[model samples]
Target chain A: MKTTELESYLAERRQLVQEALARNLPPPDTYPPVVHQAMHYSLFAGGKRLRPILVLAAGEAVGSQPEPLLPAACAVEFIHTYSLIHDDLPAMDNDDYRRGRPTCHKVYGEAIALLAGDALLTLAFEVLSRIPATIPPERILRATRELAASAGSQGLIGGQVVDMEAEGQPVTLEKVNYIHNHKTGSLIRACLRLGGILGGAGEEQLALLTRYGEALGLAFQITDDILDITGDFSQTGKQGGVDAARGKATYPACLGVEASRQKAGELCAEAGALARALGPAAEPLELLAGFVLRRQG
Target chain B: MKTTELESYLAERRQLVQEALARNLPPPDTYPPVVHQAMHYSLFAGGKRLRPILVLAAGEAVGSQPEPLLPAACAVEFIHTYSLIHDDLPAMDNDDYRRGRPTCHKVYGEAIALLAGDALLTLAFEVLSRIPATIPPERILRATRELAASAGSQGLIGGQVVDMEAEGQPVTLEKVNYIHNHKTGSLIRACLRLGGILGGAGEEQLALLTRYGEALGLAFQITDDILDITGDFSQTGKQGGVDAARGKATYPACLGVEASRQKAGELCAEAGALARALGPAAEPLELLAGFVLRRQG
Candidate 1:
């Protein structure tokens, strides 16, 4: 796929995800409107919708239409959003701005913001369990198990705990890998695997996709760390150089910027090779790898 | 069943839940041990295993073996424990103690406490989806959906949101009921309903259990409010009269002490009647309702 085609594909899928998210979300008018409103405010805050797109794209790669996979896609996004919300809490990262606007806790009070994040987390499982007709129950169960493991202590939250503990400390490659793999990589990896699982991919196909997901995830994180230091602040919508300010463990913090970029490029190439090995249906994933490697924000 | 028999049943079931919880929880030796340690700390801090007992009893009422339902029971306890952890956050209720021990945040700091709660919540669905081999996948999925909805914005979190908003304001009886029913009632209701569902309950049996659950939950909360005002602090494991100190809304606050007691008695009676309607197997539930109404703490 060409750059323009990939852009159009992402744009189109982003719209689909956004619409489904809006439709599925509890309306702002619901009882105790503030929580739903807070949830809405944070969810609809402009995002790349990359995780959901990965879910859809991976499903497509395994010869399934993406429509039936929308619920799982939305679920991944919900989990991602909840993690972001909690990460930005004053007790956590204490960021004032997200996507160039006041964070959820800034607009809503801290209590409501916290509840909103929780509700989103609960709702993710609810939505995942309610996938529309034709998907088998065992498949849903399997996906639910994967998602839970990904988001739980051994996955995303586990990564976060280690990351926090490691803050202001000397860095090691092993620790950095553990933090990045869990804190960010697990969920991203789950997205693709879930898509593959929903698509009824065989063991070989699933394994290939897992490899692609891991490479892509590592590349994505390295790019994020690079952007944190060197990218345009306006485009990134974050205060550039915040990672170094906080002394956070990052790819660039451990390896020099050039080495980190080189590492990300290698990962992107590895992911592209795995995607290509999956044949013609995996074109979207191939483009996604390049996209992550080259993304400005 | 006699009161002594009920006591034995409760003790046996509580022991079952505790063993299962300890076995299933991630060990503190796991990578990023703090979150798991924090989760383990709060979960094992000793509370009556009411929700899990309700699940087992409800299953027993419908002629199902309680062994297959242990996962669901443990999931309920996890959700309940997570709620307590988050509720005790400095951002929320700022509770210093729970179950006679310093709260999760107080012991682990705010960040690990928050993540621990989140990890527990995620673990709930993970464990729920992992019900033993004999249970049908559809039944597990159905129960998972119910649990998620009960815990989500329109259910438990929704109630907490309204409860917090109504704090410091003069609250109407209707609002207080909404707060109690949603915040506490929903999950309690879910525990029984999930048990019934797992037992392959008929519509009528499920309906009866729902009525019993709602009435019992209301009575439980009212009794709790009364205990807060009138019970011995050491016995209750709380600083007595703290509800009124915070100007928090409670059944007694809305209905006055006499009326609240009168209301609790009526609810206990109603719940007992519903449990009785479920036939001989529901004796445990009947005693549970009565126990809720007459408990000193």
Candidate 2:
């Protein structure tokens, strides 16, 4: 896919994901109006929407409409948004602002923000349970399980604990890999796997997509670490130069910029190869993998 | 049941529930030692363990051991604990201590406390998913549905949002009931309903238990409101007069002390009648219901 084609695909998928997210969310009056507002705050805070897009791209790679998978996709982003909100709490990163506005805990008060994060986390599962009629109940269960396992203790939470313990300390490559794989990578892999599973991809195709997603996830994180050093903070939204200030252990901290850059290229190549193995159906995913490697942020 | 027998039963159930909770919690060191330590700090923090004990009593009332119901009991409490941790954040309630120890956010820092809460919430489902032995998958799914629903928007989260919005204002009696019912009442009801469902009690049996639970839960909050006015701070583990200090709304605040006391008796009678309908099997539960109404905290 060419650059313009890729842009159009991403834009279309982003819109679909957003609409699905809005639709899947608990109706405003179903909850008090304030709860809905707080939930929509971080959710629609407007980042790259890369996570949900990955779900669509991977689903398309396996001959799915992406609509059936929309619940899981939105759910993955909800988890992502929650982690971001909690991560920015004064007790956590102590950041006053995020995405150019006040962070959830900052604006809502620590209590409501905490409740908001809890609300969103549970809401993710609630959203997943609302998968459309076309999707099989078995497939919904499969997708939900993938999400739960990926985001739970053995995955993301475990990784986060490791990262916190390693802060301000020297981190090994093994430790960095462990943290990234769980903290960010597991959920990303879940996004693709959910798409593939719900899209009716066979086991072999699922395995291939899993490989593609894992590699793509690593490449994405490597790019993030690299961006933390060299990317424009104005564009990144997060104050980029703080990794060293907080003594956070990042890929760039563990391996210099040159090595981190090499690792990303290597991961991109691996992901690209897996996506290409799916033949014609995988072009959009191929473009996405490439985008992960080359993105400025 | 007399006071001696009731105390013995409550004590026995508390021990059983505590043992089950300790056993079900993920053994520490599955990740870095610190993560496990952080999680254990609050998980093991002492409280009345009322919720789980209630699950046992409700379960046993329907001729079930309540042992099979412990996971659901623990899950509800995990949700409760997660709410407390988040509620105590600097942006939230900002309390430094909980149950005489530093709050999770206070002891572990905001980031870890946030993650700890997240981890606990996630583990609740993980614990539920693993039944001790063969059980109907439908029951498991039903239990999960009860727990997930109770913990999120339709239940605790809804109450929390309203409470946050109404912190200083003189919230109306209707709104206060709405808040308490969702914030705390929903989970309490869930505990009994969960116990009934998990114990494989019949639908008729479950309905009675549900009524019993709803009445007891309302009375539980009313008792809490009463305690805030009259109980000794040392005995209650809260600073007496803090509720008025914060201008937080309570039943007594709106209904006046005499009416509040009468309401408690009314709720208690309703709960006991439900338990009495179960006859001899519900002896402990009948006693427990009346006891809940009289408690100062």
Candidate 3:
């Protein structure tokens, strides 16, 4: 797919995800409106909806329609958004901005922001369990397990813990890989696997998607680290050099910008090749791999 | 059942839940050990395993064996523990101690405590989804949904939000009841409902359990409030009068100690009557309600 075609595909998918999210989430004005409002404030704060899009794309690659997969798609986004909200807490990354706006804790007080994050995380499972009755209960259960495992201590939170602990410490490739794989890669990998599981992919297809996900997730995080140093606030929606300021570990810090970019390129190529093995239905996954490599933010 | 029999039943059920929790959770020595340690630290701190016991007793009320319901039992306690960890965070309640020891955040710092709470919450869903194959997938799915909904925005978190906002403000009986029903009542209600759903209870049995849960939850919280004001730290396991120190709303604050005691007694009586309606298998639940009313802690 050409860049423009891929952009349009992403835009269309993003809109579908936005609609599903809006539908599934309680309105901002819902009772005890502050937390709901806080939830919406960050949720609608210009996210790329990358995780949900991956869910839809991977499902399509497994020969399933996007409509039936919308709940799983929204569910992944909810988990992603909650992670961001909590990560931005003063006790965590202490960021004032996310996606070019004030962070959730900055907009809503820390207490509400904390509860909002908790609510969103809980809501993800609620949304998954309620995935349209068209999907078998067994599949939904598997999807829920996949999502929980990836987001739990051994996955996303595990990575965050290691990254937080590794700050200002010695940087090593092994440590960086562990941090990146757990923090960002785990959920990203789970998105594809969740899609495949829910879409009824065979074991071989699921394994192929897992390989594609691992490569894509690592590539995506490497680019993220590189962008943290080289990209401006306008492009990244975050302050440039903040990681360096904190003496935080990153790919650019560990491997240099040029090496990091090359590494990301290789991973993306590998991901694209793996996606191709899933047949023509996975064409968009191949394109998405390229997009993740090239994205400025 | 006699009080001694109920004590034995409670002890036996608590043992089952503790064993399941120890078996299911990643050990403290697991990779990225601090967070796992923080999780274990708070989880093993002595407290009455009220929620998990409710799960087992409610399941037994409907003729299901405790062995099959261990996962669901442990899952509720995990949720309860995660809530305590987060609620003790500096950003939230900022407590220095819980169950007689320093809080998780005090021990592990704010960041790991936050992540540990997140990990535990995620692990709850993981445990639920992985409920033994003996329980049908559909029932497991339903149990997952019930747990999430009770813990999510409209239930547990909603109450927390409202309670946080209502702090140091004018107290009203209506608002206090709302907080109790939500913050404590919702999960307690979910515990019974989860047991009924998992145990294949008929509609009438489930309704009785729900009603029993509602009364027991409110009664338990009311007793908790009275204990906070009148009991010593040895029994309650924290600083006494801390609720008044924070100017938090409570049943005793709203209704006065005498009225609050009367109200709790009424609720327990109602709960006991509902459990009695569930037939001989519900004898334990009936006894448990009286225990809630009479316990000092």
**Candidate 1 chain B: worst 10 consecutive residues by lDDT?**
B232-241
Regions of model 1 farther than 4 Å from truth? none
Question: lDDT per residue, candidate 2, B1-297, as tens digits?
Answer: 797899888888778877877886667766755656667888788878788887777778787777777777787777778778877777666777776677886677777777877877877766776655545655666677677778887788888778777778976999889888887889899888888887778999999988888888888888888887898756776666666777777898889878998998998898888999977888877888778876755
- In model 3, the runs with Cα more than 4 Å from the true position are none
Return the TM-score for each candidate structure. Answer: 0.99, 0.90, 0.99
Per-residue lDDT of candidate 3, residues A1-297 (tens digit): 677888899999999999999999999998789999999998998889999999999999999999889989998899999999999999999999887898999989898999999999999999899888888888998899999999999899999999998999989999999999999999999999999999999999999999999999999999999888888888789988888888787898899999999999999999999999999999999999999998998
Per-prediction CA RMSD (Å): 0.8, 3.0, 0.9
Alpha-carbon error at A149 in model 1, in Å? 0.1
Give residue A106's lDDT in candidate 3 (0 to 100): 90
lDDT of 1 by residue, B1-297 (tens): 799999999999999888888877888878787888898899988788999999999999999988899999999999999998999898898889876789999889999999999999999999999998699899999999999999999999999998888889996999989989998999999999999999889999999999999999888889999999999866777778788888898998988999999999999999999999999999999999988988885
- lDDT, candidate 1, equals 0.92
Evaluate model 2 with DockQ and give the value: 0.40
Off by over 4 Å in 2: A1-8, A27-31, A56-65, A132-146, A196-206, A278-283, B1-8, B56-65, B132-139, B200-206, B278-283
In model 3, pairs of residues that clash are none
Ranking by DockQ: 1, 3, 2
| lDDT (0 to 1) per candidate | 0.92, 0.80, 0.93
DockQ of each: 0.93, 0.40, 0.87
Task: Report chain A TM-scores, every model.
Answer: 0.99, 0.96, 0.99
